[model samples]
Target: MNRNILKVTLLAATLGLVSGAAFAEDYRQNPFTLTYKNAITENVVGKVNIHAVNYALNGVNIVANVYTPANYDPSKQYPAIVVAHPNGGVKEQVAGLYAQRLAEMGYITIAADAAYQGGSGGEPRNIDKPSHRIEDIHGMADFISQYPGVDATELGLLGICGGGGYSLKAAQTDKRFKSVATLSMFNSGLVRRNGYVNSQTDTIQERLKQASEARALEASSGEIRYTGDAQLTDEQIAKLPFELYREGFIYYGKTHAHPNSTFRYTVSSLLELMSFDATNNIDLINQPLLMIAGSKADSLYMTQDAFIKASGADSKELFLIDGATHIQTYWNPEYVDKAVSKLTEFYGKNL
Candidate 1:
């Protein structure tokens, strides 16, 4: 029950490794409240337009942003892609960035805040469970496939970070996705159950016991306890074990932060997360697949592991961005451009 061990356990679950004293942009001016660079301020007549939307997902209001291609014609058919955000990430961060970029390439894209997180509605926020996260992706596919001008038969999917892991699970049987792609893909279950690169393997049972007690507390007293919420100084961030966690603090905490994004989740979520694995039944995915990761990312093993197990993919390719670490791929322009170019090619051919 040491506080530090609990903090690390929750941080691994939420994927927001560093918290406290983080910087966030003033997004009051942007109607969409987008925190990414060069976000759309206004809808141009012939340029891509972002539509803030909300819909019911199992009685909860799921908020999302759907981007329409330039000169979009409702009557014409257009392929669509669903962009899933990373763990502890909102639709306005990297998910929105990639959604907008793909829209510019003539693909209608949707980026949604997962239920219980971001702008979406859910009680006892930040659950971070595999079932709910996976359901969110499937819900997005359900909504976007019916959107105006979207060719239901030509739908594609793009998942980033933890979202990438859920996307693989959704595409496994959904099959509506003609193509599937992941960026800096993170296997949330593997990390939650085993710790980042199995760093906390020795304490797996202890954590599970803690998670059970947390769940019991929530059920009996309705008092929810959260974890992974910490206030760390610059020095602490620098000392993080993995480069991904270190850079993640700067990316989600400072360089590109949103008010809705957080690093905390109900401690009980680990009860489910501890046993979940994104790679479970991964070979069920039969569509074309493209998995992208950074050559230098400490988290690259998750991508490599999932890619190798995706034996059922009609076609599969693993592309590594040179010199890019896990978080750099989220915002660095050079790396982003390379990723977008490759995605454009992949979706163009497969979707």
Candidate 2:
């Protein structure tokens, strides 16, 4: 059989399958360079890193990484933050970057791969349901809060991209997060249902029919169909229309490529994702909230819209990165620095 087919077949056999080839001894080495800046290495002097941590949540084993401040001691209490990765992302990308940076700033932070994706245990992998994603955030808070030296009362949350939307939902009832922050919030439901920028408004019913078919196939355990899974040539990528998808391909697929991260999600996931909206029940979140997005980012509207609807929160602010786009805020040093700075200040005041 062809390699790609073999890869998919193997993934379907079991949950938590690391994409491509057999699982490695250490996910931080060889083909897996977990961090964007490669900040983590063999000699971690002052700081501490615990990787591939397994924890049970919602009947699945979650894999996460914990980063602690220098001279970390379990006896002492310290503030903590749980970072949520973007959609189609694992914990190691931008989420790890933020977690490590926050750890450097004297906090215990964790970045966990969502169940059914990355190294986490889940069947029919890449399920990508809203409830599952939201639960992942709650689960992170559950495990990290129990970690050594974590001040459960001073916990904070930072959600990036699609994770941001789910964070809002999670924070609504999961008051364990004293403060909530989202960077480059992507309204997955709105975009999935109405299309990117509402460009597919004309095709809503048509796509729903397609999704229904996908769900039917899934029930029978038939051939699984996926969406947004593409390997594009450089020329093809350049011709893509939208900045979000175009730059995203380069970021997630090329420069930041991790064996575990893929754009494809089960097409059936749309059944739930399309009908869900992150901004629903916005009034339930009364905690300090900060939403950051690049001014040039096409997804800025989602953040702004959600921010406005967060009427129950007495303390909520929207900060925009001046010249960055959606994906640029992920790894661009200058942009990342700005985002982290705002987050540090926000968490400092709130947590």
The TM-score that candidate 2 achieves is 0.90
The weakest ten consecutive residues by lDDT in model 2 span: 9-18
User: Per-residue alpha-carbon lDDT of model 1 for 288-313, expressed as tens digits?
Assistant: 99999999998899999999999999
Q: Give me the runs in candidate 2 sitting further than 4 Å from their true place.
A: 1-32
Candidate 1 runs further than 4 Å off:
10-14, 17-29
TM-score of each: 0.96, 0.90
What local distance difference test score does each model get? Answer: 0.89, 0.81
Tell me how candidate 2 scores on lDDT: 0.81
Best by lDDT: 1
After the best TM-score superposition of candidate 1, give how far the Cα of residue 8 lies from its true spot, in angstroms.
Answer: 3.0
